[model samples]
Target: MTPTPDPPATLCEAFQRTVAARPQEPALLALAGTALTWAQYAERVASVAAALRHLGVRRGEPVALMLTNRPEFHVADCAALHLGAVPFSLYNSLPADQIHDLLANTAARLVVTERRFLPVLHAAAAGTSVRYLVTVDQVDQTPEEGVLTLEEAEARAPRPFELAAALDCVGPDDLVTLIHTSGTTGRPKAVEITHRAMLSQLSGSQQVLKVTDQDSHISFLPAAHIADRWGSHYTNLLCGTRLTCLDDITRLSEALALVRPTLFGAVPSVWQRMRTTLEGALAEADPGLRALAEEALATGRRHAPRRWKGVLTQAERKELDGADAVLAELRRRVGLDRARVCITGAAPAPEGLQEFFHALGLPLTDAWGMSELSGIALIAPPGMPRPGTVGRPVPGAEIRIADDGELLVRAPFLMRGYRGESELTARTIDAAGWLHTGDLAAVDAQGDIRIIDRKKDLIINTGGQNMAPARIEGVLRESTPLIAHAVVIGDGRPYNVALLVPDREAVTAWARRTGIATAAPWDTHGAELAAAFAGAVADANARLSRAERIRVHEVIADEWAPGGPELTVTLKVRRAAVTGRYADLVETLYRRGAADR
Candidate 1:
């Protein structure tokens, strides 16, 4: 059977229809305290679309969007599609040099950015093919004299000209957007998405999530990533649901309270940090407050045992009911009540973290996807969330594990090909339409798939013993309070040693409790550092298997950064990078560096 084609050619048509169906429904909100109805949002999208056409944007041209999580970013994206232009996003966190390289490679005609990012654009525009620089907000000056404010262009351009008819030119095969993966190991590749691909993905997502116009979600993940765009922005567009955008993560808690969103998407790193923050604050809190928080978390853990399988035991269900009442009060205190489903993606979240929230009556759903698949391949359903599994494949998608334990996927949502890299694309997606996911996964008789780890990321010691670091890391994180990332290194060595990055806040509280002289856990405190970190390592080792256990862990003082030998651009730990950087330290650890302790 053929898949359904993408509708809403100009985005104007799709949105206008939605507005007509429910004109008064709120469509968009910002953490900065602004809301727009569907009717109002469509008008803005149309005005922006008209503006882009007036600026000489042609169909098939690539428009680079370099803005943060503001309303204009979404408007600009919809406008690009309206004019049949492909929108490519650049991470705002990137330096101007990286931005220049991307623009030069993609040959983008225009660069859409926020006013605050004008200087960076100007720096990149010193001498480039990029002619028209479009800034969403007011700016004093632009690097390129040809720069046009989005406001100016929209106001000056006449009302959109028969957009519904103009959209007839776009086909399902037309490129809808371009996203550059962080490319932790190599140069970023541009992933091209088509209208049909996006629509198919949204269809699969809707079937699993049951999202509708009544649902509101928070958007903060970089749109430059395919997962963030499809899961947060495009899904909302198709469902006619409202999305709240917040550019600053510092204001996330505040944003949550105000928006009271029903859905939210974030990586494990962000949620792990939140857990660490709450845990640390509780440690230093008043005795009464500390006890209350502990009781609440304990009650939640009992209700929803972190390691339980899909079917809850009778005792578990009963415990959950008793725990739910206590957790309800805790939810009110933590401001997580309105967050009906907190979605985790990009990496496997620690299972304990998932159950902690579930016990508290919040659905922390885990999703799996890759850049090539246009974001999601599988998502845990609300009714059947199996711990440690990424849940079932979304509707219309198929997942099969190869004889060697590699997970392969095939779906309409697969990318057309790696932009301008036909050979690489062919190697990834075969003639039979199966995408070799490069991941190792396991499936039970019931069809739930649990991603063990990346095939290449697995560790094999000299004795021919293989281990999945992700599993060990997950267990270790649950055992300790402050550790954020655990990279087990012992491929050719006798035993595994790890480089652990502590949650700065959690470590600080532990240090203070022991009367340690360290100002911060991330700071170098001389000899005392070895003793403090050793204790944390010992605690973590208690939860690991003999072979998987860390012999000793070195505490780093700095946070991990991409291209800095510790982390990938997506904020995932780079096992190879860590080993390369700390080759000398690994030798010392193997020589029984902390045996005396």
Candidate 2:
């Protein structure tokens, strides 16, 4: 059973209480062996607060952070909270123009970034409200006019301010942070998170996740993302859980093995890559080992129960234990041997990925939430997760499907409003205080919510039949290992078509084996690649309805990445942007079909 969490009036109170309770316990760990105990972390927060105060940061003012997932992010965020200031988070990889726009929107005066981004920051800060730029790393050249290193600022602090008085000024209703939406459909909007909303989310998650002090977490997601901020940062601070900060996301698998975290949270993309990597490793194992592993997985699936009610019979426990033993090496190899709870959110996961992990005795739970909710509104229970559903509504969050099939949620942790967009916020949040989530979803008989797709992304063909692009995209990607992403396009067309992004490495391997003489797989226009993709598309079409079937597809040469116009910072494809950019290619696919007709 989960213990009732002690509610703190403000974030600072939570941090202070945790530090007082576990002063010697590890609070933060970096990839480079930099560790800080709770007490040490608090001392740094105090120093940072003093520095901010010395720099004239007043209460309620926005202090932006453009740093990566490092210890300083926590320090600076907590420092802002300690000063009763709003911490505005910015993705480090965002283009300079976007950064400038956000800074102007928030009127942020001070931004903390790394030395490597100095030039970009400088350009963005020009003619904006930004007055000071602080670097977390050492600079090679002489400092710019308004630039200062964190170490220099800390050394120059006159004295540590009295935090108790500052804490007294902070209240539950005070604005805590400004988190931006992913902007997959359009421009990013800043969501205003308050102290009360944040604490409410922490309480709700605690009831569901049952996170304890003994559990450790690897913080690898982008720090600016609300999932990382609310799920990882706030949860760790409030629960007194040890958090290991990952510097490089590319080395996440290595970090996972080294940290062996008990609680892990990630976006669906990260989970997908991990799954692909594990499956690749299994396929390359010795034939005997591979056969044994497959048999173990099969047995585990056969014995796995549908739901867990927190109690098990002795025989059932023993059987599960045996299955765990059989697949122990496979779990160790995947670096989830010690994980108790693994969660994926921010985007829809591919079908069967959750079940695959569950067969291995690891419940890869799917969750659903947005920036407006402060944190997750729905989370699949550890052992009782339904494959396609995103579980039930969490405590303090009431969910209902609107008449138009939109999901409406009334949560205690809903954002106060969208910053500088009261009209838009009013439209989004109804007078009854329910947030009208733009997602088209359905509540199953068991009350689990299954998101179909974004309302705007829904495809209505010329035949007036509605289809979900996300469903088709997921099927196409899951049908073959070579396909990385799929964007189904048939909004008002005769038939559905798709733009597919191939997995370059997988394509290269196939090309090598098939004798396709091409230096770059992405650049290759070989018949083998086309045939392989055609086979994959056929597999996907076999499962889809006639109206939803992808009739034709063209594989793109370039991969969609963040910082590109077509992909958001969280890597969600901007459907409109992609279609607009590849208008000619999409037209060609349809034009060929018309010619055939």
Candidate 3:
């Protein structure tokens, strides 16, 4: 692979270079067939920067953004960066009070949002430093006391935008953004990322991705999440990658087909859904066709590891040669035909999930990172992915396993510190500069890292049997696509039980195929639905050890979505929230043993 050139001193400089180098290239895209050229994107950023200056925004001030994934978000965020101001995105799913905490913590006085979120923002802004509500879209163009549309802000801008002057003041160590972690344990803490750290991590990640201007990305996940921020915004700023930002994540499948991006990244759940979709369709296919597809998958898997090692025999090479053609069609059907690299991280995927994608000719790369590192610390090397491990560390990351199995990282990508929490930050990052990542991990002799679980999330039963809840949950999700989410419970209990949220589409299809039609509203407690879940749970348990298996399970009645109580915007399960929300149900399951089922 060719070496990447030296990274710019700051992202603002990188953006300037990209705009000068590829002015006519498509930079930002929308689903409605709208495109913004690199020059137009830069123009938008300048306009926003001018408007911000007019509103009294200055260097070192925090600007909070709360909006959907659109070209406007990129424009506004880049505007803040150029102004030497810190720009941070909030999860649209966050509650008014959480927004209150974030604004108070950042001491941000301005919030960029649309009219839909005004009610929530108004409540959050009370008794805080928040003084302005700049809406991207509002019904009335007229300005209110503390609220105005984006157009009005631009209209009030002073002549001769001093964007260049502002950019000149920015430095490498200056704070670029504040990314809040998905607080599974407590309140989300804002991670302070600097220009130097973002640049370092991005350049290091290129060793694995080798990202280039020819690449394209479709953005659906929340920009608040580090993964999407890096994939959609940062990559485009530095590498000139084309970006298609979607407003709604539910339409991700439709957008994927439309963009057919060269680079695709998602949480492990998305890959599981794709695996299930193809498997479900094949389950009902003609016997001959099903057999042929199965044989192709088997052949692909048999050749994948050998090919990854560059050790294919003549006959094995011929077998893969035949299977790849069939697998290529499958890739096209799933809208990954143009994909050069597919990445999955943010959570653990079941052991076989990666191999499943490899069996279809796409190497589903396992990755590992966190908000503290600004994402992508370790990733499976392109074309040489290992199924069960998040591969070797990227260029600048130095990793070591602590005595108690916690992973410690010393990297240029490390965050400056947690925002407004110096004491907590001191506890997290030791005096030696090694960030104590609370994840339990084991590094194999090959230098590949296998994440066991979060150090605090491991379950130890009353009888002293210990296991990782993530591994069990992963196995359950992989047993069938019908199960969308699984929460395992047993910390100090006698045995484990699970709460399963089934996929509505997959479950409906299964019910139709089995002729077990619902008489009334869809009921998760219905005998037929229970039977289906029972089968899936049994299948999953077969793959787990006796201690790790679920003794009893309850299927969730309602579908859990990204913005819901059960899931973070990035689609990671909020274990505490789920367990707390269903405390009564969990207690009931324990009171009435597995015999009750």
Candidate 4:
């Protein structure tokens, strides 16, 4: 491997150079259907930076960002970098108390947020030291009593920096981005990501995904997460690509069609939910239409090339081309035809899902990394995907497994360490500069990594038994019309208990076939489909141990809500949240004593 290239002196100047080179090009597309040219983007960033400096935001001080995915977020972030103040993201949905704690913990004086979220800042800032709050939205909604509008704040100040010298003090080792972990178990710790670390991630992603100036991204994912921060934001900035950030999930589909992006980042749940929606909708329609849809999908899957398998022959190629028309129509409906690549990260997506999309002609590439590594650790090459595996380590990164099943990573892209927690920082990152990723994983013969699960999530029963819920969930997902996600609840009790969130449409269709009359819908649907889910649960139980078996459980109609203990912004379950939310339900599952069996 060649020595890594040097990083730019400052992240802000790099953007300015790019804008100067491509002023008229589209730099950002917002969920509101608004587009910003590189020139416009640069102007906004400059104004915001100047405004921040005038407000006495000093270099090296932290500026907390609490806005959702919007155009202001980009401008505010770029502007903060220009002012040489490290920008940290706080989950916009975090409870006001938690938000206040984070603000005090990070010692941030300046905060940027949307008008709607100002109440949270008000409540959280009651006794905290956060002195100024700037609302990022364009609406003239009544600003909180003391907080100012981001626009007004900027208008009051002069341009902060006229040239590179003003930003020359920001070196590669200086903090560029500070991301906080999803504080499920404890208070969230700020991860210091330096310019060098971010550049390392950007370079690796560019090489692996072959991102170019022509590339376009739909950036609705929370900028708080490293996956979205690097893959959807910084990568686009570094490669001179265009980014489209949407307001919410409702606007995402429209944004996709409008932007017709070449590259986008997604989590597995999004892909799975979309697939389930399409399949269930088609299945419920008339027999002829359902058959036609299934045939089209199957045909597409048949023609799609397998990543792990060898290349197809000439005859195979011809057959796939013949089915191109049907597949193209299907792709358009799914809004993925324009996408050259869809990168999935944060969690392991089922391999079969990746193949299904590939068959439809969308290359769904899987990547692996953590918040500590700034996101890009490994990724699959286009058309060379290995399903279930998180591809190989990104360029300039190294991965190794310990004797005890822990995955370790060493890269310049690694964070500077957990902020203010020297003990945890020392424990997570070793003297050798390797991050001890607490995930259990294996590197295959082909150098692909298949992560099993977090070592911490491992279940240790009272009977001295250990089990991985992820493995059990994987097996349960194999069932036709599969489960969305399952959380095993039994720990100290005699056996495991799983609280399953069923694929509602699938279960509803199964009900229609089984002749179950449905009167009140949605809320009562879970109870109505209890018997069906039980049968599936029983089948899964047969494969588990006495301690690991899910003896009894309940079904939830919809997924857990984000910010509602059960789900993270990326839609991953906080196990503690899930267990705590349904503690009574879990206990009811095993209410009957072990002797009863």
Candidate 5:
């Protein structure tokens, strides 16, 4: 008979083991000018655990966190896990109605939030299951009923609370967190993640990245997202790496220069902004400098290793060395000079953007995963990423194409199920334990997964030809710096049309250079601007198939953003919402026999 393997350890147990071994190591650096060693952080976790216990938080109970990407978020998350409580993360920007809905759904006992969000929480938690409102920041107003500050909680809790026995009670099967989906289609569903799944994901990340204690990271993404929680927070805890928490995401470009992290992860939108900034800077540079930078990038690309299998020849190395100054300056500008590995995920990035980063000596590799996976399942190997492909599956993850062309994954890190949605969960995960990913994917000969598009987002034209709108949108955005966002519309239609959102800054700069008087981006809608957009559409059309080519396009003046009806918190465009809002504009493109622009 085969021997049975030891059961997986709980997240709390794993964290304790690391803390015991590296008590003196720097664990977290807060942007507020405070740093916590492993020992100090563990102490805080214990204290927070005691406070929660005093507050009557029990095993399997949900403790909601509505804070930003701060050290307190990590502390509260770990503290809840220490006592086997489930940590439910809530976006700070969520409206009162959604907050109330989620709170009612989870039946959260306590909500840890800051003062700025107190008004919303106060309204949402009224007559709900919430027993207490734990504020992280102090406020001038008197404490309301059931509201207590973090300091007050700690003061009431007994000192030197023992956590070993409580942690030992936690098992791998215990629910670790309840992460909600982005709800792009409809209401957000809570995904039940387990300790075993999170641990498996951390193990896979460790195997692929080989991160060490010397490596550093900065947390700027929303902590509510699984990619940030599992990929950055939990990974750092398990690896004994230093993590810096950013106070404001708007200052990320400046933070990068200060933190100079060795490992960084961001969505495609952030990468696009960086690329646009760099391009704009280069375009404004002197002719000599521009030429030098271009030559350096070309040389870097020529000498860059493929699949981490090639070595640069001595002559090529020498040529690259000559451009080191320019390369270093460019890298410093983007705050990636020290980045050994930079990853982009959540949404697919343009192939051109990845190639541009590669040419600049920064391998911005593509990663693929969803909230249901607990963490990323597919990440390009360091120094060996293949452009346009979200690399092969990580260890312990099995990926196969379904009969209907959807990607099916059987992974140890898959979520337990959707909380309070048994019917939906059963429909998602089959009897064979395969999680049906709603993405259409194609595996190359090398086993790399190239995602085509979301199965439901596929646009079938009147000619019976299927086209991926995401692919076309990616191409459209990459073709011109002026285009910030693009949505291709042609489902069951005669031809494809596009709704484009222009980059306001880029357009304003162009107008200034061309001596066009414009008060704002919308004011500069002259023949010149029209020609620029038309040129961009033509360029994108040249690369697409005849049937997939965008025949007509219109530019929208208003910018799409989070907190808007047409966008999710992560800034993903809601197709139905956008189409409905601009229904007349879309109809005009197809109805009036508009010229191909």
Candidate 6:
């Protein structure tokens, strides 16, 4: 079936519509007390546009962004968009090498960034096409030797930037952004999404979310990720949802309490941590109150199905009402009391994750989508969220389960192609136009989809964070000569851990420095080797995100060789074979916990 066309010709048009409707409404808010009305945001965007236009930026040009979740990011991105330029964001956690590769691929001459990322940006910009480094923070202060500031850009506007005339620069087919994600084999693939596709996704999301100017959202994820762009940023342009920019993920708790967002979403790890905290507090509460809370949750679980079906009897409704009363305080304390719909995406939620929240008077809906689809293509309908299933395809998306169980999707929001990878794009979307999602999934009678397993080798951590294991393993090999081979393990786990095969000769040589005898666990020499492995792991982790860092590692006493159980004939690490052989060891590594990294 042909997917529905977006009502707006382009995202620029949708944004203008929203601005007209909510000109005076709070469009963007900073956790630090800065707020911008829609009109003000448009003004700032136009100012940036004038600056970029002056800098010779034109239609189809790429403008890279390395920013935290800040309002300035919105301004810079919109400025690029209205100028008919493509604005793509690089993951803030990406190492200098990866950032450089992305910049080279996009040929982005201009990059809008902040001080925190300037060092990496400067390093990455070396020998690349980058000519302008626009800093978001330190607006009026002296920037790095050759960088311009965000305020300077706005001040350089030749005249009041005209939004109306500038809107004519681009159309729906124009590329909007490039979402960089892990490819099937380990390299990063930049998924190309156009304005039309994103607008379609926003429309489909609106059918379920029903979001409007009344809705307020917390921007927690990096703008580089598709979830943040689709869930918060693009939604603003189409639905007039207010955005609270949370620059630092660590401060999400305080920001949540401060903003009390009406529509919020987080990865499973965040929800899991909340559950742990809630359980820990309940364990320490007064005995009588704790008992009441447990009983209320139990009652809630028993009748939640009836509530979802809207067939709850009077007695059942009263019981649930009491349960709601019992958990209301808990909800408010977590700043989720006002949340009409909460979502978990990027990875499958752990079993019973949905039940825990539903029992607590909160509806935690799970959705499934990838970078290629823009976002939120398949969502567990908030009205009837079922455990384990990511519900039916959203309006305007068609889904089918292939004979091999691979989930296939066709939607207006689907990506046009990968940036500079036409062959890969052709492989992903076949002649029929169905995107092979590479996920093993099942469709129930109700058209709900339950993801069973992944067909690819990418690792998605507990917090719904995705990373390429091959990239990490490559870094590990470079981190230290003592490591013979490194197998990263963190698929659906709380954090990353690694199995490191040590080169015996190299370990023994390194042991000479520490005056250790053998690499035996009983010997003090073992501690020295473990410490060495730890150091290498730390070095590699310095280039990764918190979610991608290896928490614990086990140095394998046995060295791996080509064609061995853990290695291919080509000397590559056979990931599944290595993990399968050391399943117990990997489990032990995770049991050591996520803080040791």
lDDT of each: 0.77, 0.84, 0.87, 0.76, 0.85, 0.80
Give the C-alpha lDDT of model 2. 0.84
Off by over 4 Å in 4: 1-7, 31-34, 138-145, 158-160, 284-289, 300-310, 460-466, 477-483, 490-494, 502-528, 538-549, 557-559, 591-596
- The order by descending lDDT is 3, 5, 2, 6, 1, 4
Every model's TM-score:
0.91, 0.95, 0.95, 0.91, 0.95, 0.78
Report each candidate's C-alpha RMSD, comma-separated, in the order given: 3.5, 2.4, 2.3, 3.4, 2.8, 11.4
Worst 10 residues of 1 by lDDT: 301-310
Alpha carbon lDDT of residue 458, candidate 1?
84
Which residue pairs come into collision in candidate 3?
none
Model 3 residue 59 lDDT score: 86
Give the worst 10-residue stretch by lDDT in candidate 4. Answer: 519-528
Give the per-residue lDDT digits (tens) of candidate 5, residues 228-254.
888678887777888999968888988
Candidate 3 positional error at 506, Å: 2.0
* lDDT leader: 3
lDDT of 1 by residue, 1-597 (tens): 999655664333555567677667777788655577777777787788888888888889989999888888888888788788898898887777878888888888798887788778878866677988888887785344778788888887876745465457777788888888744464778888888888788778888888888888778777888766886778767778888888887788787778777787788877776666666666778999678667766766665544235466678677666556756765655567776667888877888888766766677888999888887888888745667889888998998899999999999889998889999999999889999988999997777889998898888988888899888888767767667777777776667887777776667777787677775444654566566667767776787777888876777676776434466556777666677777787777777745734
Which stretches of model 3 miss by more than 4 angstroms?
1-6, 141-143, 284-288, 518-521, 594-597
| lDDT by residue for model 2 (70-188), tens | 88999999998988899977887787888889999889999988888888988888789888898888889976788999888888889876667656888899998999885686688
Candidate 4 local distance difference test against the native = 0.76
Q: TM-score of the candidate numbered 2?
A: 0.95
534-557 per-residue lDDT for model 6 (tens digits): 888999899777777877877777
